[model samples]
Target: MTRLNSAATAETQQSWASVLRITEVAAGLPSSEARRPATPAVVTLQMVLEKLQAGWRWVERKRSQQISAKRLRVAETISLGEKRTLSIVTVDGSQYLIGSSAGGVQLLTKLDDATPNNSRDERSQ
Candidate 1:
């Protein structure tokens, strides 16, 4: 009877050890339902520079800065009163009539923009 009891006790210890092993493995593994999807790696400026060193030309990725080409030019001016005057100014080929008085400056009207193409078209006509 003592030998039978000892055999049963050994089997119970083995079963408990197997249960502890299963618990440890389950704890170490990440849950499938809770796991997040991996995202793609982002391209950095350093990566771009490395590619450029390898003779890769970056065209559109680097934007070309636009320098201001428009300049204000007074075309014609006429006095309206003692302190008031109307001046026609051209900016980037567009003409505008501006009024200046003792109070302040005000935009009077917009005239037809005079471009080289328009002048050429007029001369051809």
Candidate 2:
């Protein structure tokens, strides 16, 4: 097997990461102005984790909690074969199993009242 240069490998990885970000942002653009193919909004692990952690931080900030005792922790990680995996995470007293795969990332289940209530605000089609 031919050996790949370390610098070349890192450069290629960086280029792909940049391309992925560009594609993500382009896809986020309005349909009329978008140059990429139409598809469902891509939700990466980073996005989901960020949203989850942000919500917690917001609540903590609102309550004027100075000490950073409460923190999101990954309790366990289980591979469900293939590229799919289940992560059990906890923050305060709440726990959730987040499923991540090539298809998408979703909350398998959560022991908390963190779900948003938007149905009452939604307008009928």
Q: Write down the TM-score of every candidate.
A: 0.35, 0.33
> Where does model 2 exceed 4 Å of error?
1-70, 112-125
lDDT of 2 by residue, 15-61 (tens): 65665566556446687765555344444744654564556457558
**How many clashing residue pairs, candidate 2?**
0
The number of the candidate with the highest lDDT is 2
**What TM-score, to 2 decimals, does candidate 1 have?**
0.35
Top TM-score prediction, candidate number: 1
Candidate 1, 22-79: lDDT as tens digits: 5445335577732754333322533443454333223322322222443788988999
Model 1: residues >4 Å from true position, as ranges? Answer: 1-70, 114-125
Local accuracy by lDDT, each model: 0.67, 0.68
Residue 114 deviation, candidate 1, in Å?
Answer: 6.1
Error of 2 at 109 (Å): 1.0
What's the distance in Å from true for residue 2, model 1?
A: 99
